[model samples]
Target: MSTKINELSVVDADKFTVSRTITIAAPIEKVWAAVTEAQHIARWFPEHATLSPLAVGTTGVFGWSDHGDFPVRIEELDPPHMIAYRWGNSNAAASTLESGETTVFRFTLETVDAGTQLTVVESGFDALRDPAASMDGNRGGWDFELDELVAYLEGSE
Candidate 1:
């Protein structure tokens, strides 16, 4: 099967932030839930996930068999429009944002004639122990995971 690849751009070399954007063939609400809700998120992004209420300060955890669990907390939420989270370090055993080894993950959705435009921007790589390697890893991670999201959502319809 042919795969859809999202566009990735390095926003700042010094800050180590990268942005990825992909258009999916689904409504904004559906896309929002797929990104925010634990069940839908697990289908695409993580092996397993648990999210609290859709509000700021709500905490969650994303688990991968290899990486174990990474703690996450909602820093911002706007229903079907935007959601942002502070997630623990990918390269370390950080369970809290207070550990000072975390990154910001922001997902923004926009309605369009075709479907929804989803943009994911993950920053704070400079705080990691190995910024370059971490940026490369997450960049590839988003490319693979977002394609799974499109396939899951579009194929389900």
Candidate 2:
């Protein structure tokens, strides 16, 4: 399967949400694993990720070498179909999920004729320190990050 990296995420200025929908040339199961599993996420997402066993309340840390750690929690889960994470947006070295303005990013997946169609909706940016800046930063972030996900799943990375 082949994949194209694109800036497909949409920033909603009024709703304080950023949404992106992309079709992956891989099975839902594979894409689900890449998104939900920490090892796979660390490959494409943060430099290091620590998540506990799958559960709605499980908390973890998504860490980056330059950006530090972001505390994350599983806000919702529905097997291979959906999972939502609430994470702090702080750039501090180590912070709790409650230490800063947090956002919920929900990933919803569907089986398509070609493969899987995944949509991520990140909301609650209105509560950030700088709502516009945070929204803009994450808009670009989701574009690059999800593109990596597509490439990783399609074996083009």
Candidate 3:
């Protein structure tokens, strides 16, 4: 199977949401695990990750060597179909979910002949001091991280 790159798009300039979609050559269950499970997430995205039970209101942290851990809360969860997290804003110091300076990351999955179509939409960039820059940074980030995820899953298979 061939690898695929994520398609990036801006939801709206004023809203400052970055959306990305990638098709992976793996089953929906495998893709869901990679996106939700800490062990699988650490292998592809964050340098380190700790996720609580996969349910609404559960919290977690995703850490990078350069940037410290960022608090994350499960805002929405729907089995192997969808999961959404409200995470700390990259521009501010790591903070709690109650803090207004947080962003939303929603991931939706659909089974396809290729395997799964994963669409990730991260919003709330407008809440940050520098919306444009943050949106641009995360656009590149999702591109790299999702591509890494595809590589990890395909390689292991």
Best by TM-score: 2
Ranking by TM-score: 2, 3, 1
lDDT tens digits, residue span 1-157, model 2: 6544444789999999999998899999999999999999998999899998989999999999988888899999998999999998853223567755788999999998879889999998887777788888898899999988988999878
Worst 10 residues of 3 by lDDT: 2-11
- How many residue pairs clash in each candidate at the backbone level? 0, 0, 0
- Name the candidate, 1 or 3, with the larger lDDT value: 3
Model 3, 58-115: lDDT tens digits are 8899999987788999999998999999998778544667768788999999999889
Residue-wise lDDT of candidate 1 within 1-157, one digit each (tens)?
2244557544567768878888898889899999989999999988999997888999989999997888899999888899999999767546677888899989999997778889889998888888888888888888888878888989852
| TM-scores of all candidate predictions against the true structure | 0.90, 0.93, 0.92
Q: Mind sharing the TM-score for model 1?
A: 0.90
Q: Identify the superior model by TM-score, candidate 1 or candidate 3.
A: 3
Q: Which of the two candidates, 2 or 3, achieves a greater lDDT against the reference?
A: 2
Candidate rank order under lDDT: 2, 3, 1
The lDDT of each candidate is 0.85, 0.88, 0.85
Scored against the true structure, residue 88 in model 2 reaches a CA lDDT of: 88
